[model samples]
Target: MPQTNDPFLEIRPYHDEEVPAAIERLVSDDEFISAILKYRFPKLSGSFRWLFKPLLKQYLRAKWSKIKTVRDVQMNVASYMQSMIKNTSEGFTTSGLEKLDPNQSYLFVSNHRDIAMDPAMVNWCLHTHGFDTVRIAIGDNLLKKPCATELMKLNKSFIVKRSVKGPREMMKALGQLSAYIKHSIDEKQSVWIAQKEGRAKDGNDKTDPAILKMFYVEGRREKIPFAEYIASLRIVPVTISYENDPCDAAKANELYRKQEDGAYEKGEFEDIESIVQGIVGQKRRIHVAFGDVIGNEFETPDALAVEIDRQIYKNYHLFPSNYIAAGEDHASITDTDRVLFDSKISSLPEGVAQIVKSMYAMPTAKKSDFPIKQ
Candidate 1:
């Protein structure tokens, strides 16, 4: 367990010393054991949970016996990630990472797409290189289950309290979050956070200025200049491009429902289901592009957000699907790409198909608006 007097203990990831206790707790937790049974042995899990839970717990205990530190947990996760990539993706590639200094910690603000894969990909790239993996930022909304919280924290994820209500409570949570991020950077630990609160369902990747504002909360409290504070964090805008989104159809359906009904509601565990599908579903190719650190003078959050968006747009990799959706020709577009893109579109309703097409096309559209900086 974490020290009782630690202020950030509630939100921070588990310390190396706390890993053993956490692992033991997880193996013993009924919910966690049941979840494993359901995912791995679905047909038998519902009727035979009593039979499988104990066996699963024993298996997990034996499997995780050597995982005594946080680094051990991350290595285990990395092994699974490698297997998942091999099974679900054609290839994974990265750019601009070679330019980064492994010795320096950075704040990576990336465009959100998949609930979990965005940071996972970033961490994988950094780990494969000489750089240390980043501390991921995940929202509280995704942690309704205690087991989920344990699993995330075990993998170096910190909580962002998005569920906090009331203005005072919200402000307090934001302040603490900002302070924790700054503290991590000061300790030479890099952090990964989305540019906005949610995934860009519409495929339009824009940095919410409010997110930038939240980052400045601690700086403002200390009466520091905004530009200097921004520069100090070494903010790097990262763009993650997928040749095909695993949840594209679901996203399109939700958007279509919202357009017709003016509101859409999620099922109790829909987010969790999406996370699972994203991990296992097919993603043809993925590219992660790390942009230059923001050292320019920007006096306001909005200005900083604009620069971040520009970099994301410029660095975003345009896949064949994007070119096909945008009705543009590219040397990379082939007959196979056309057939695959068409199959995806044909699987959706006409209205939802248009939305999905637009979603894929937005990257191509936005690229023209923000040309690459020479």
Candidate 2:
């Protein structure tokens, strides 16, 4: 943990000066090392841990010896990101990035799809375009393991205390989070948070008004007008579209089971599995669209949420798969697109396949209902 008197020390990412110690902690963490071994050499990790664990630890220590700063860690992550993109994606593209001021730190509220890839793709785009990466907002539920917390914070992520019980505690957590976000913006550091608490597993992206309300918790306490306080944050709505979601089938199955069982329970490590799958799975093609920074005209969180949703829906890049699943005719649709879409659908059971198709079709359906702003 960061040893400091800072109020947000418990939730905020580690500072540059703290990077070396954090790295050392991670290097020394037996669970972290074992996790890596299980991931990279799954078969050998169980039966030959005596032989592989020490070697892996030595390799990690040597590999991270020179990484003394947060930027160095990010640069290393960037290299891996580049390799991942090259191997797992057909192509990556972006729009509306030119409109953002490089020097101004904006609060980027993005549609969540993949647990790990959404903010990562946003960070990659900003990093490659000479803009500073945003401090990501990650829920505490995702940081159940100490290693997970270390990894996330090292990557410029702040914790959102989602599991805090009781109304008063939840409010306090939200207030602290809101203050941290404002403080980050005031310090000219950008932030990226999901529009809601979790990924849109069913593929429908909607901004929850509660999230917007949470943003104003601190502002409300300070007696700041909602609109003016919102404007000050330079809130931007971002849309990320994937031609192929690596976890679509898994997501669909989960959703379907929930529908059948009336509730769903996640395995202890299911989220971790999803994160790894999202990182390594083929995405076909991906597009990230940065939207216009919102103005101060909206008077309430609900209204602000509507506008954010509007931008996300408008800016979402519709792929041929989306159109095909929606049963819509489009000039961009091709024979190969049909074959690939069909193959994905055919691999699942009929019920789950329908859910998967509906998931892909949702963006198209939502976009059609919400027309673009003039």
Candidate 3:
């Protein structure tokens, strides 16, 4: 059953005849799905279509396409990602792949800005470079469906279990996550992870030291640091930026919730809503900037965190919107090597201004700043 907030989630794949039998009953009976879809996809729907006019059955088949192997899943995800970049970017440019050594494995960490496009853009970069690319670190909270589950796993996404209830449980999960991440990298493959758990809502992209420390709690508990374990894997910073975010409303709600409730509860509904917003929301020309590869062998997580932020800022691609926002917000601009702010803005049309502004507004030098400038 779909939650009242989003009727779209409730509309799973179904045959044509089954529409009246399976899907239509919801719109006729629920009212919420009817009201929301009518509001959102009005182009595809008609007045009476809500009840008896019927929607196309193709969308159902689209979700359940086909997935039998990990390879199939990987290509599907890559191309699905490629389609978004090809379709969304008015003009896209990438730099710094030559800085990455394909022969070596890297622990790729990046700033988290846009939820939907970060991993997709990262994969696009690696694909274009001919590397097998990365196994991404995704939160279990985002795996809301079978397709999402298979897609991430196919693309080498390991889940960080967010459901642990106790400190002891949390410690165990951290150790397991550490081992899995190290194993993936030691095999000469790279892994992509946001510096934080979710998209840095509100455009703040700072690295969380706690996440860095989680990489070694197993050794800490045993009276020895996991430097040996960490040394075996290479770490790199990737900076990903979207020309615009498709989910600002969701990001804004998160900022509001943190201010009001002291925390945000990303319930199943919020996850579904974010995913919906990720796909259907309007996004203009997205760009993912690649940062330099780094050595993950570190003395401490704090040191690693500091270095991560440095590398992230080093690779940040500034545009006109960021310059303008920084000027307006009185935010300090420290890095100005890539492109001049005014010139960057001059490159965009009015339609792309909102996106450029959002990217510019991102928190500098943090994982919350979705530079994906890992």
Q: How well does each candidate superpose onto the true structure, as a TM-score?
A: 0.98, 0.98, 0.69
lDDT winner between 2 and 3, please give it. Answer: 2
Candidate 1 Cα lDDT to native: 0.94
Model 2 clash pairs? none
Clashes of 3: 31
lDDT of 3 by residue, 1-374 (tens): 22456322221222223333332233233343443555556675465554532343344334434543445556766777666666655556777788777777777788886665677678777777887767777777776655455334545566778877898988777877776666566668678888987777667677898887876664465566555545555667777765446665456655566766899777666666666567555455555666655544568877777777777766676543454555544344435512445554556554354445454565342333433432
User: Per-model C-alpha lDDT, please?
Assistant: 0.94, 0.94, 0.61
Q: How many clashes does the backbone of model 2 have?
A: 0
Instruction: Superpose all Cα atoms of candidate 2 onto the true structure and report the RMSD in Å to 1 decimal.
Output: 1.1
- Tens-digit per-residue lDDT, 288-330, candidate 1: 9999999848899999998999999999999999999999999
For all candidates, what are the clash counts? 0, 0, 31
